[model samples]
Target: MSAPAPPSSSSSSSSSSGLVLQGADDVEDCVWENEGEGSLPWDRFGYVSDLVRNGNRAFRQHRLEFFEKAVSYYTRANQIKPNDPVILGNRCATYIRISQFLKLRSASDSEDRPLSGLDPTIHAELALKDAEKLVDIQCNSVRSFVLKASALLLLEKYDTARDTVISGLQVDPFSNSLQGALQQLEKIHASCTGSRSNTKPERTDDFDCTLCLKLLYEPITTPCGHSFCRSCLFQSMDRGNKCPLCRTVLFISPRTSAVSVTLNNIIQKNFPEEYAERKSEHDSLTNLGGDLMPLFVMDIVIPCQKYPLHIFEPRYRLMVRRIMEGNRRMGMVGIDPLTGSFAEFACEVEVTECEPLPDGRFFIEVEGRRRFRIIRSRDQDGYRVAEVEWVQDVEFPQGSRERVDLLELTSNVAEHASSWLTRARQAAQQDRAKYEKLLSLEHMMPTPRDPERFSFWLATLTKRRPDEKLDLLRMTDTRERISRGLIYLRAEEQGCRLQ
Candidate 1:
């Protein structure tokens, strides 16, 4: 073999091919001279591959500079034979190493926690591009798919990463690498959703909230040297303005205090699995209704009336506490005396105010919002829960005779109710000293002009059997409720005259 000549100073030189060749001589010596031998591309590829192999060894030995040196050789080889899969794959592998090294180094770097110097995201993206090209070149290349998935995973494109792994598994069904990647993705999904994981528990105490003796969720701490789950503390404070453990008076309202940042971080970092489970559990309780609300079965609460409650039972206290923490709303179902469960129809109520008494009871005031018919019922935490679809007023067709008839009926009912109210007011006037409060009923009688409001208000004020009141509550048609109210008012008025 003839000795290779050193190039002139202005010509430049590249010794990556293991030969002293001028940059100007590279084209002629590589392609033209070695055309007959057909070893030019192979020689360049072999030389680059050797550099990449040595770079891999150096990477394992922590020789960081060798990555840059190997990249230079790979670039030269790629320029000589563009789009060569072997060269692209080797270059991509080197880039991946650089990204991994930077990421590992960044963990201890104070300037940035996950990245510094060269952004690993850029390298990972570049590796992804090369991996894509490789996959295009070799449709069934398992290595390319694995590499692409790894790069995507590093870039936090979890869905795409999982899909890529699945694609690889489709091509090579028994690949352990693909299986491992899929498992990692499942873990990530579980962590984000607060679902149970297959891994062992982190620590028992880390996951437990002191008040609930369950997993910590929306955890908060009090100034009285205590920490409890936010909902748990709120419930405790609702009963008595003191901490359950220390009985120290808590001046901070449950709504005002922020979540403990340090504790939240520790829980998220160390007990991700349990934290995910706890979050899922809380969501199931609070966000219960899409179309149906969780019902509180106890009384016959009519719409547009305030229902005051003294929550003392353990189950009911739990129910009210959940209501306060959630949307502050629940369905009020009357207990069916026949079946001992709950009536099929109920009115929804929203908590207007909640006063926590010192003995772990709640003085809660709720106002009715709407009515619903039970679709299903179950028991949860010792209280009856029902899934119910909201009952809206039946809208009569426009210009229909039904609407006109209902209007006429409502007017007649109102007149009779007014007459009953006038008679009651006169009776109270006959004894103003003893019946002072009944005087206000004269003015309040005509205030509820809305048929729905009027019907419910009449039910509350009128003396009626429980069954008859329940019948009014279950009535969806406002006209029917008003007709029943008219009958009740007429009967009462006749009784008053007889008395």
Candidate 2:
């Protein structure tokens, strides 16, 4: 085949391919010349040559549609001769051109008639994929590196694009295209950094999450292009799956979505003090100090007990969502019948499992952890939050007479409890589900070495009144708790109900 004619000035004026191949003056220069053409069957060679000619001609036309046509023709050529370096490179360049055109076109240009095709990002991503394959197949080609770097640049990956150009320069230190790309990348990067550094600090709604009315911390940008603090967005999303700003129906959840790192860095770097303050405020809620916790006002819970809770109220649903995001722990407290207020003592529970329903409710399983004595209480966003002191049994020194006696007492009580459960399991065997539940509870028993925890586990073997559980939470004497656990077991064995 004869060498294709050099591109003319007239063709350049009407060319769409020039958008991506701006450094190259002619399309013929972009295509490798006569490398493997002789090896191809004549009929297949003629057909591929025709396809390439048509693609080159289509891209030289002054229409985006024609640019797409060029890509389609190159794609067919590629399918016929898989891994043809020339065809891949041409198709990759065409995709980059389409992406660049779409991205640079003014909104006003398409305001009247929306362009019906893949968006800029998708095109750029396609270009990047092809460019990557070209790099893998033609590792030594400067053009492959240039194409990949260009696609990455259009995708806004400046650092990676800069690195790609640098690597290409290492391959051919005298290549002007790579040198120019390196310079262009440095200038763009410097300008972006300089612009951010030079801009005056301004406090505006632009940096605040609409949901929280505060400086955005760990901001997440939705697919709809709206940004919010990650926690604030999910809190609002817990109530409804819609962008709080534009109400665009959101398909992302906190579990799947990630913080917008660039936007977050911009905000944090620009407004350091405000960002720090916002972070501290957020930490206060999510990581309350050792003595403080958000409280769930419901039934009493004792340590070493496990149960499921249905969170339906808006306040508790909000609390559950936050807890799941944070440490997955909260205080479970009940009202004091005498004072008609939250009980002074409560148990801390960790959410072991959580399932958020579509209707803004949570089905959660929690395991009681430790006890706390509320030193002060307050309302937070319609739920109870308390400053408390963690409660634990007063321990006798190890190897002391008191500790030895306590351990012996615990072993005796454990034996009694085991025998009682065996009988209870036998009695409940007629009901398969009840027997299974007892078996599960039996498996959860703690060792007598952890007498305090074992006492609570024993107490759970039988259903107790709310006030009785409250008393258990308040007791700091492990031996006393164990004695009470034994009494409860015996009472149940004797068919006596404690009111």
Candidate 3:
């Protein structure tokens, strides 16, 4: 009422609260006293009420608006408190999250060339530099460090990212996301090893995924007579369906037995312990046994379908023999992202049906069991080796896998999804139709309980890389994963239709 004091306030109808304040404000001051520091007493500095408001807004119900406000305010805040660790740390996080949303939006919004350069993931990074400035200011948050590492890694600053995450892990060891990020960087670096000729496993005490060499989970043996997690093999096969070890074709023509009696002699001779572990795990019934599955040192990717794995690679043949006589299950793992050997995450698979081929291969139908994420792979004597930690989301029956007439529900869902796909396809442009169709189906799956079958069915509809399919397969959370699958398939259908 008294001329608004220093006359810092203004009215704006476009924004939520019209009261925009103005005053003798110095951005370098970082903190501004409501009535001037002379009028108030405190070392209180490096923050402003506007910054708080913007931060709060960023986290509020209307997140988009909040983030927009944060972008402007935080940019101003960063300039003033550029070296203030707390301010820098917080601002860094705010930028990263905001940027993530923006980048994703830009990606999805821009079809021909999804917005790339100016995305928030980029801006969030600049904010991160400001955070690093806070190291001298003695302010760092675990969140800040992790985000920084993630940002750097995404930007392909692999070495710096790995170092930053390692430092953060020393400070906070329980950050699983950090662990994943570190592994990702290591995987990239590990790629420097020549080509497939260098694919030999150095040690077998701990097995590495032949493809990426992280940790193994849901480990799947390729029909080509090579073993790796479904995700790892799938990812490699995605580019060109080939064995990670021998470059043998996996999905083309007929898979052969590369494991000759000579190779079996090598494995048995080179590292018996690891070979025994592999054999024991493959043969043991109840596979990994109860909750102990996740606690194990190895992870695998398990597939839901069965193939007559009757190939006569003596090592694999013997392994399958044991698995079939018992649980009839195998694990699927990927190459470790760190060591680039075996990935830690994998799934436990149980065979529901198995029919031996006339050629001694196996044709089987299987269901997924426990899931795992690769942790660390250690070398043994001979066989490719490593320990895996379980990380997949396996739902308790009470959790998301409740028994129901899924077949009927999925049938109805598929029908609804198909209609959406057809319509969106017709409405969208040629190149856009497929993605849109997938999104439509994915968006609709949640309302239906039997979306699992629909999700898998939709999975079959799209010809994605094996890696993409495995991502869908690893989704143990029926409702959500299926929802994702529905969207992807329907979007593809729609996009194709439009074209």
lDDT (Cα, tens digit) per residue for candidate 3, span 239-354 = 45456678764432111111223334445555667667656653342243433321212232333322223333433433444454345555645444456654435655665444
The model with the greatest lDDT is 2
- Which of the two, 2 or 3, has more TM-score? 2
Structural similarity to truth (TM-score) of each candidate:
0.48, 0.57, 0.29
Among all windows of 10 consecutive residues in model 2, the one with the lowest summed lDDT is 1-10
Ranking by TM-score: 2, 1, 3
lDDT of 2 at 104: 54
**lDDT agreement with native, every candidate:** 0.61, 0.74, 0.45
- The candidate that wins on TM-score is 2
lDDT of 2 by residue, 343-386 (tens): 99999999864545545566788999999999998889889889
Candidate 3 at residue 193, lDDT? Answer: 27
Candidate 1 whole-model C-alpha lDDT, 0 to 1: 0.61
Give the distance in Å from residue 232's predicted Cα in candidate 1 to where it truly belongs.
3.3
Preferred candidate (TM-score higher): 1 or 2: 2
Instruction: Give stretches of model 1 more than 4 Å off.
Output: 1-215, 222-224, 233-280, 415-453, 496-499
Name the 10 consecutive residues with the lowest summed lDDT in model 3. 18-27
